[model samples]
Target: MAHYARRRCRSACAGKEVSLMKKVHVIGGGLAGPEAALQAAAAGCEVTLYEMRPHRSTEAHQTSDFAELVCSNSLKSESENTAPWLLKQEMRRAGSFLLKEADATAVPAGHALAVDRVEFSRRVAEAIAANPRITVVREEVISLDESGDHITVLATGPLTSPALAAELQRLTGSDQLAFYDSIAPIVDASSIDMEKVYFAARWDKGTADYINCPFTKEEYDTFLDALLTSEKVELKEWEKGQYFEACLPIDELARRGRDTLRFGPMKPAGLTNPKTGRWPYACVQLRQENLRADSYNLVGFQNHIKYGDQAKVLRLIPGLENAKFLRYGQIHRNTYINSPAVLNGTLQLKAHPSIVIAGQLSGVEGYTESIAGGLLGGRFAALLARGEEPVAPPRQSAHGSLLHYITHAEAKHFQPANITFDLLVPLEEELRKKIRDKKERHRLQCERALEAWGAWLAQSALPVG
Candidate 1:
């Protein structure tokens, strides 16, 4: 069996030599961690993938499955020429194991890549189990001290265990290491009022993949009042902190001002109500939950309010008046390190080069962003094991932009980031002036990034497959 597995791995790597492989310890079996392990294994490193589930559990996860998505099923936009699309495209080109699994388990979600959570997790577990160079261990990793000689990739994600988190605090010498993130609610598809809500993607970009609940001025005001007066879940003393700006709960955003939500998530721009034949005062969009179309998630409707009050407030939306919620919005602690103070662009800790961090814990936000980190960290760990220098993708690329932001952003003001064009290096001044359209500029940037990424992949010691 061992010999056959080695032959399979060697065949996958195009018959590359696997003699004298070094051990790679990956802490956590979430999206980034497993991707790192797979990439390392593909690069000829022996990997032990650790997951502390079933034996132990966290607030967000409900299952023991590897790479179980705790929040939304969507992996964000798949629209071409966009930053998220570009990042996923690069990962697919580089043979990201998780992305391949995602594609295999994908559900119809307009232009966004959504998946059946259960199937996705199952496939990830199956793939990890079948890999010869990767070993799965269902045990809690409580300390970085355990990884003495082997290369360690910390992809434990935002819901890292307390013991491991404490150890990390001790290692990094920083106490402010955690933040809060929220999850949106999901509703049964049969509960939506088809007459009240119209199906359409924003700006007609993709297939009419979203169910928009258009609101009149009076309905918007009533809903806002309910949201403001809704009973909220009290935060524990230790869980208190400013919420990450990117994942702010609905109530938190409402606290800023009455019009804040109208301008933010609930904005009606680019969406016209079929009944009224004009833009409504505001709208709440519901995205498909799974391939079966049994449920839909309230896009950008995350809140920390009590479930009862949440139901009451949410039902005030135009089409959700009869909505049967499959899951209520909840908030959880999302712990992440201050990466700029500790991590290099290659995702290695400055104080300890052997220790690499990836995923949400590494301070990059969004699903695709976490996978990108893991891919890089795993590849770098494999290269280091082979005594080769790890090369980062070009700064012009989305991968490099995300790495640069995490490692070089102002430490005092450091926060997690989702992939955005702003993070990538701006186009040349001459070109920018010549091409004044923002979309056109982004197109050029994507073109340049793909070119650089291909060149980097060719030169790097990591395996392309």
Candidate 2:
């Protein structure tokens, strides 16, 4: 750790005039941007937060609220010793503003850290409004200010405006990588047929928070056939690319094989049918979407099929035969830069430390991962504003490993990733061979990560929560 810090000291531009500024300009008001503004403010840097919304909206967003969560309400698992949990733990230790809002507005979705997105966004907006150090600007940033005295953090996320994207491409002299991200449909709660579906969480771990749609083998076959024949929303020539496998549209998944949906999102492994007293042939889980509990989204059911075809195919599931959809599954262009070719370990441009790139734009995926990027990027910006060398988190921590993966991955094959045990620094060979239990190995990794994270936070030159 000391060696890495010393290495950083040798190249850091602490004495340069650019690092002496007290101002920070953050573009975008999505999950990562607002968090960056708050963290920079907390570190005593004056922040100008820009959000071009309502007046200039994107394809997927519906509201102008800061930190609006569009894709899904669930923020992944909260089960202890899991990768997501480890990341959130580190964020809590650092006093992340968005995470706090998520906690306050949480609604039941079994063991996952789900929230009422509307309430959560409102709370974050309130925090930004009340903070004296943050000045909100409602407008688009179409061009880069290369000569500004203040440092800039670009966090425009997946749907970055075309002009800003072009400016970034021009600045870096590299074409930003792009992907297709799909979102699932939200169903009206009252329209679901209670008689056909049952309420249960997988393995009956605790309170039943999800509504499970069970299927017999015949039913599953019928649905798959309809899905295979459905009309889909075709991608334009420029917008075409294979989607991230993790978020593949259901029909795209079905094309893999007849049984693909049976094991993928529609898998029935742990969910037991109360009426039959056995597991169904297949199942589709519905997660709560908000605090009101009046709506639920099809879990892992993201699709790009035409809206009418989507309704027809999805309704073939037993309980959804008469279900009313509040929102149909849709796909959007998800844009991001190739981090290894563009960003440093501190998530700043290699040639320009004054410019930091975070959020989905920085190539980290998922809700928590985006916030983690913002948290770290904001702190680094704060350090630079104070004319200090910005330090990267210890590699053992979730924050460190995630940043490391994105910044160190091979440029040609780099893809945005969620926090997973595979991304973390592994245990020594001897330790791995000695402990064969997968769960125990994971626990040890989590323990080691948190300890290192704590030491780094305490020992940083300028500490940030």
Candidate 3:
């Protein structure tokens, strides 16, 4: 069996003739690394996937499972209306293995692609394990020789091992690896004062799902004061202070202004409190955290507050007066590279052309975005393995915009991003000025992106089969 496997690998390496067996080593068995390995394997290259799980664990992940959705189980929207939705569509068309598993394991989440986290990871792991050309190795890779010619994809993700992280720092010559992301707390459903809370999804367009804790003007002011004054978890000495804007802690929001949250995530424009028969001054909305409906997470309430402070201050909210915390919000480290400064459009490090960085490591945010990066990195790496030069997605597509941002955006102001219309190539000047409705405009952008992405895929010489 060993001899046959070796022979097969050798045959794949150079069409059964070359002496040297060409193989791709993918470090990190998370979304990007496994995907990269699978792609390379599919393209007739032997792939050895190194995963540091079970033996070594990161701050975010608790399981030995590969491609674990540590933070969120939702893969965002599956509709074509959202940029992430469009990106998923593009990835599907491009034969993304991850997307196939996600589809198979998908749970009902309205329009979003939510999944049983365990099942999702298990499915992904099984796929990687079953792939004949891919070998899964359980070990930590603490170093990489960026000067070498071999292609190495670093998908170590946000919770990268410390030693490898240091090695990455040495290679990049930048202090950009991050180590702190905050999660929102979930409250026990039975504990909340439902009399003061109302069930309503935003815009009343979806199911009457979210439990909103209504706040009057005085209540909101007091809440803001408490939030601002609440004790916070301090950063570690060695860890850099960086919070992705989308998940900024409430304390950081408080620093902006008393009304910062009111205008930002706490904005309650559409729903009216059922008990009061009016929209509250501002609302703290909670969504069912699990399918069991026992706990509900505070939407837009990601925080770094001390556990005691979290309990005390969260209780101050109108409906949460007697709330029992199911999970206390905690902060963990998130690592990433300064993509704009170090990476090209393909997420390959400029100084180390053979190494490609994907996922949050490339400065993109959200689960889907991370998977998308992995998808692209895998395809790019496979093409390179085939001796075909890597190709960038068209600038008009979401993937293209992300790559463009990582490679070309101003390094001084580089920020991790989720897909947004602003990232897309601008619509024609005539269309931009003429479009009045934002949703309609976004739809137009999506349409154009699909068209452009299709054409680009057709033109690319990479073997789609």
lDDT of each: 0.88, 0.88, 0.77
Off by over 4 Å in 3: 1-21, 104-111, 147-150, 177-180, 188-196, 460-465
Give the per-residue Cα lDDT of candidate 1 at 232: 89
Q: Which has the higher TM-score value, candidate number 1 or candidate number 3?
A: 1
Candidate 1 lDDT by residue in tens digits, 1-465: 121121213555567754554579999988999999999999888899999998999888878888888788889889989999999999999999999999999987778898888899899889888999998899999879533367899999999998999998888887646678767899999999899999988888778888999998999999999999999899888787678888889999998999999999999998977777899899999988787888998988888899999999999988888989988988899889999998887998877777889898989998889888899999998977666668778998889999999999999989999999999999999999899999899999999999989999998867886
Best by lDDT: 2
Q: Order of candidates by TM-score, top first?
A: 2, 1, 3
Return the TM-score for candidate 2, rounded to 2 decimals: 0.94
lDDT for predicted candidate 3 compared with the true structure: 0.77
Q: Each candidate: RMSD to true structure?
A: 4.7, 4.7, 4.5
Candidate 3: give the clashing pairs: 178-334, 178-335, 179-333, 179-334, 180-333, 180-334
The sequence of per-residue lDDT tens digits that candidate 2 reaches over residues 196-266 is: 99999887765689999999999999999999999988778767756987888888899999888888999
Residue-pair clashes per prediction, in order, are 0, 1, 6
Residues 1-465, candidate 3: write the lDDT tens digits: 121122223465556654333467788877777777777777777788888888988766668888886665677776556888888888887778888888887654455676666677888888887999988889989989664345677898888888988888888898865646766677898898888787886666546767888888999888888888888887677656666777877788889888888887688788777676777788887766555666777866778888898888889888899899977777677878888888877777878777888888888887788888887887777666555568899999889987888788888877778887778887788997999888898898888888888888888755453
The collision pairs in model 2 are 94-465
Q: Each model's TM-score?
A: 0.94, 0.94, 0.87
The candidate with the higher TM-score, 2 or 3, is: 2
Consecutive 10-residue window with the lowest summed lDDT within model 3: 1-10
